[model samples]
Target chain A: MSKDKLTIGTLLFPDYDLLDVNGTLRMLGALENVNILMISQSGDKIKSNCQVGNYIDYNFDNCPELDVLFVPGGIGTRKEVNNPILLEFIKSQIPKVKYVLVVCTGGGLVAKTGLLDGKRATSNKIAWEWVTSQGSNVCWIKKARWVVDGKFYTSAGVSAGMDMALGFISDVYGREVADNIALRTEYDWHDNPDWDPFSDKILEKK
Target chain B: MSKDKLTIGTLLFPDYDLLDVNGTLRMLGALENVNILMISQSGDKIKSNCQVGNYIDYNFDNCPELDVLFVPGGIGTRKEVNNPILLEFIKSQIPKVKYVLVVCTGGGLVAKTGLLDGKRATSNKIAWEWVTSQGSNVCWIKKARWVVDGKFYTSAGVSAGMDMALGFISDVYGREVADNIALRTEYDWHDNPDWDPFSDKILEKK
Candidate 1:
């Protein structure tokens, strides 16, 4: 990790959501002084929830120090939440990283670590109940595109990660930089953190 | 390639945009019984514009027959547009596929092949001039989130690819299926094809 540039380590597990990682990185990667690293358990090609295979850059043992830690959720989180190695790795990175961003069910994996116990967070509306159950003490906001509490940023399912990533940029870099990136990408960014429309619709189905 | 399934072969080159491919696939991949194969000049890890490396599933010569051909644009298109191997590959796939989906400067790559010579299309608004220059006879639309000309579907820019893809789904599958996929992904889908706002802003800057 360079002293001048921010290092972002994104965790990749089996069955990880493609958009949750790539969509968010699409915005964050535009930053001029950021080192993005894809980290998996074994540094192998991790299969996404969409069945796409992505080769990772680093693994648990050899990952360099990171300024930001990103975790993307998928069906994999259901099984990975119980994996001791992953839980321990999340716990290890919590205290060192300046920011922690969790997308979709990834909030469940991090919440299970007990670090966000008292912090306000959110997750995929589709998996709200399951994820909310993971952290009994965590303040889970149901109606949010994303929630930013202290050093933690958690977004709603899949595509909402992009918005959360932009919000993260707005806080760290400034509003102009984030807005410029959105314009460059031609992304219709929901600047408001509370602009969530799926909570009621998705929750009603259950 | 299974006869019963729709095989989608996405072309990858060095400096290809990550979200252009992944974001589009994030929507399309949700379709049941669709085969998604990543293709490149060589079956190797191709570096993205963001400096991310993605491993491809097939090389041009060995690629199986595809129902849909996808092309994503990045800085690589500037150099690749002149590359015969790539130009020939794009030209060859034009007549065989059921649909041709081009994202960003990918419109430039396909247009350079002369297949889109008389077709109505569009590309990244920021790179409007450069992309429009690729196909001299092509009818390029200046204002559109995406344009569907016959079998061809072209999107404006990076994140717009997701909207174009969902539009592609809505057209092919029923509207309900596409809407369900958008709901599942929790994506705020701009369902209208003419919902482009960046064309004026980006082109004016030039």
Candidate 2:
């Protein structure tokens, strides 16, 4: 076990995707010395897009400096992209965190942070047009399950967050650690970074 | 919107797998006229196997008869299979619900109800030996992502529950409804029922 602990904060807003935050939590929170903290703007219980309320561990103002900031996206991300408080908070944390992970339209929220400028990233394919429309400087990949641009990690959509988290575990913790977690979950992970079939599925609908 | 609302009850014990319940919720709860209710022995919030507390919507004593019963397996399942109170509760509901879904080691938990006798089922591959040991009369399949034996659906492991839920939605709802949900999440769902590769992975490890 690593004696050194890494405080991993997941920023939650009202109507956040339940699977988006919870799936990543499975891999990231399971690791030893990785403290998982659910954070929200006011420390109030955040309702899921599914309407279930999730308890928060900390309010934005009181949260400690994070080693990893995990951001998940949902219907709420559309409104929060324009929230100055959230944008400023994300901006302030970018320089402090060791890594920044954005899932689904979470990339949209992070893109609003002015952090994805000149970085390769991705977001929910179904909402691709709307999500990428917010980030002018971002070099968005159209077909990727996930993208790793230096310390920033962005995934395609809801379930793809799990794939990115495992990939992240492989990058930071070791492949063996992630493989064991995958085995434990029995998740046949789409290990190939470009194995994004949903991109075409979403596009084909048009 | 379907005016016929179905109360989907997820059976919660201490240390339940969060992904098993939440992942399926992302699919089933997203459907029209589906009510997601988390039920436990007590209405008090149940702690996930990962230690995060999930608020329960109802207690066993007052819960309305469910349209569907969702059972998820985890580390705590090892102790729950022997609980007479839980087995009796599961038995009582088996004859009332329209569908019974069990995920991962949840197969072990449900098998104790004696409801799975002679029914085709599957469970978490890693815990295959111990889980199968619990339900000798159940016809356990080794190479299946999910087994839909009439109204009962049992799946391989944690993540497999989501795939099973999508399939369940396709069966009860329509393909378009399930496809729309899959598209909204940008999920490349493993549509093939027999696409379980983890069966070999676990066996090879032995």
Candidate 3:
């Protein structure tokens, strides 16, 4: 890859969890040849529920071709799932991107767009049912750090987005690169040997 | 406390974790009457690692008359600690604000301002030593959700800022109001009886 040349697109919508979007962006920015694009439903600044900062860059309609498309989840996904324009855009872009990454409730959006049907997927624990309800073809994985079924990758809850992004980096580059990225971000990234999404271990009493 | 009259200010700096700042802003936006302000050392569009968005307001040279001041932390704190201009501004405004809330590494900035001297404080676990080293007069509470020593309220890590803000609402208003706010925001505001700042159990172990 050329220096910071990987085109990474982050989806933005009203009421989306800014942390998930920003956290992933922070990690990706550390890469030498990464070009991060903030693509929103509209070509305008996206006002987050956090109201801290408004995203601006490319609109879904005007975004340049992307290498990776990352969809972040939040309460915003509840409405974005049904947005015809947004769904069409996502559906059209899936085939062109190298990787499709979804975080938390964002997995539901991917599932809703019919991209994750029959593919393994995961989302925020509270919204796993909603993700499943969107489509039965998706093999929903519960409490997974992140699930990779084919080229579609999904994660659980807010912070999990960072881990999933690192995982994607590992897949594209190498584990060493991902670990160095994690260290630079001050995140402790580990592969859980005992963790099982299908097992009752996560369900065991804390 | 009047409707649409609350002016909330958040300090932004280089390398600041956008999540900590945005998360707190999202919670505050859930309230009916609050105007958010993004203050930076420089009155320019502050770029973060996430590339999610740009700050709208700037309070670099002239501090806005604010109802509350929020400071978020990240690797940026290391640089902010030695910034004479920023430290002077924080010191000048410590006594004027209704509340001074410091999140994550931001607590270190507050500690450097000498406002937390002789008061209880907490910060990101990794930077606890740096915070302590900055000033020995402060009681660095190792295991606490947030240290509410007088008007200075400090929380641990990035996400803990949300809990600390909710607690601030509870203290300023009441538990019932805070609970209502939590319900509206869809956040499960649990009183973590075991919330120990120094305890390794605070975060999910890798």
Candidate 4:
């Protein structure tokens, strides 16, 4: 809860979506004093769905205390949801971090943790059925850009994470700080959490 | 220019902006048949400005034929503009690629090459003076989300590259394809190149 420096631990895995993590990091990185740690199960280079690889800074064991825990969605989450090691890592960090951000299908992974039970969350609309199936007890909102329940923030899809990240900045910093970051990055941030346009288009197709 | 499979080469360097590349890639990754190659000067892990590192797929010497050459912006551009190795690599790829996408201060690096001498372009508004100074002969537009001069595409700040990427997708694919990607990602695509809001805000401040 200290404001001096906030360390954010980002969970990464093989075939993870690139934008889910990096796009959100773009908004968070603009903050003055914040540290980013890329963490994987084995601390090796994690390859994205695009076949691009990123170096990991820490493993689950050596990860330092984090103010924020970021989990990004990708094809890897399908297999990782059943991974007790990764699931245990997410569960153990939830109680310790000040905030948890689940983007895209990452909502499914956290939903599997049984942490969002009786809580509201949202995930990628295209993968709605799979994500919602993971947590029957969790309240899944289909028409939401993002959902914030207590300390957890879950977004709709890949780029929606950027908007949710700005919302997080608005909460942690101030509205002005978030707006300034949007201006700096030239991002037209959908400041309103409920201002989602794609949910109906995608969900209705199903 | 092959319709079957397009190859994209992304240039990376130390202290490169994370979003400048990934945000754009988020839109491009949605394409059905495309290959992404991360290239750097040394074919080593290049550190981003946020201190995160990405593994490079190819070095300048080993780089292959590219359909699109992507250059990302960051604080490193100040120094990279003078890096002859990178400049030569960019210059070498320019004639071969169908399109060259430059994001944020990356315009400065490309401007140093003198290839955009008489072409219209734009860059991160906050770094306008520096970027414009890099190419005195280039016609730099002060207010634009992105500028397209023949085969080259230059965009404003970090997140603007996403809009440009969508624009690129629309140009190569159909407009419906670009809109579908936007809908899928839940991104508010600023379709018009002239719809820049930050240029006057940041540029006027200076």
Q: What share of the true interface contacts does each candidate keep?
A: 0.67, 0.62, 0.40, 0.79
Q: Which 10 residues in a row give candidate 4 chain B its minimum summed lDDT?
A: B1-10
**TM-score to true structure, per model:** 0.97, 0.95, 0.76, 0.96
True-vs-predicted CA distance for residue B148, candidate 1, Å: 0.9
Candidate 4: misplaced stretches above 4 Å? none
Off by over 4 Å in 3: A1-5, A26-33, A125-130, A142-145, A166-206, B1-6, B26-35, B60-64, B82-84, B128-130, B142-145, B159-206
Model 3's i-RMS, to one decimal, reads 4.8
Tens digits of per-residue lDDT, candidate 3, B1-206, equal 33436788888887777667765665666676777888887777666645544555776677578888888887788888999998887888788888888887888788887778889887766566776787788888777667787888888776567677788777766677777655443344544523753346433342
Per candidate, the number of residue pairs that clash is: 0, 0, 12, 0
Predicted model with the maximum DockQ = 4
Q: Against the hidden true structure, what lDDT does model 4 obtain? A: 0.90
Candidate 4: residue B154 Cα off by (Å): 1.1
Better of 2 and 4 by TM-score: 4
Across residues A19-121, which tens digit of lDDT does each residue of candidate 2 receive?
8988888777678768788888988866888857566889989998798888999999989988999888888888899899999988889998778999999
Ranking by TM-score: 1, 4, 2, 3
Winner on DockQ between 1 and 4 is 4
The predicted structure with the larger DockQ, 1 or 2, is 1
Q: Is candidate 3 or candidate 4 better by TM-score?
A: 4
Among all candidates shown, the one with the greatest lDDT: 1
User: What lDDT score is found at residue B104 in candidate 1?
Assistant: 94
Instruction: Give every prediction's interface RMSD.
Output: 1.1, 1.4, 4.8, 1.3
lDDT of 2 by residue, B90-160 (tens): 99999999899999999998898889999999999999998999989999999999999988999989999
Better of 2 and 3 by lDDT: 2
* TM score of chain A per candidate: 0.97, 0.96, 0.89, 0.97
lDDT of 1 by residue, A65-154 (tens): 999999999899999999999999999999999999999999999999999999999999989989999999999998999999999999
